[model samples]
Target: DQQVKQNSPSLSVQEGRISILNCDYTNSMFDYFLWYKKYPAEGPTFLISISSIKDKNEDGRFTVFLNKSAKHLSLHIVPSQPGDSAVYFCAASHGGYQKVTFGTGTKLQVIP
Candidate 1:
């Protein structure tokens, strides 16, 4: 069973709009949640992240929200641009160890 899951396989949004991606997890020990953006044939790059201690974290146009009780998290991209088009993966890990679980991924397409 996958500990992390991204229900949406893909999402489309117009340039300069908002894009929202959802994720869910089953592990209660997950203390850190992260969102990574990957381009075709390229390695995933870190995006926003949230700690279990906080309900939300934001950086520039990216924001991550975590709901511990619900074991849910979501990523919001404001004013989405074409450059933001990519596959986004949701990941989680408990502190200390290097074991990390990742969600399948959600492909976001920003149309001009």
Candidate 2:
């Protein structure tokens, strides 16, 4: 069973607008969460991450939030740029295990 799911396969937003991607999980044992950004034909780059101990984490233009009670997480990008157009994957891990189960992918298209 897929532990994590991103309902929307893709999202399109204009430059200077906000982009939000949502994900849900069924595993309650997951304590560490991560988000990765990927470009075409390239490997995913670590973007932001949060631990189950905290509710939110932010770095520069990217922010991620985790709600343990709901087994949900989200990523927010403000003032999205054309370069931000890429796939975003949400992942989770536990017990020092780094095997991250990725979502199908969320293709964020930032229009200029």
TM-score of each: 0.96, 0.96
Deviation (Å) of 1 in candidate 2: 1.0
Which pairs in model 1 have colliding backbones? none
RMSD of 2: 0.9
**Residue 64 accuracy (lDDT) in model 2:** 95
Q: What is the lDDT of residue 73 in candidate 2?
A: 96
Model 2 alpha-carbon drift over 4 Å, by segment: none
Off by over 4 Å in 1: none
After superposition of all CA atoms, the RMSD between model 1 and the true structure is 0.9
- lDDT per residue (tens digit) for residues 39-58 in model 2: 98999999999999999999
lDDT of 2: 0.92
Candidate 1 least-lDDT 10 residues: 93-102
Give the distance in Å from residue 65's predicted Cα in candidate 1 to where it truly belongs: 0.6
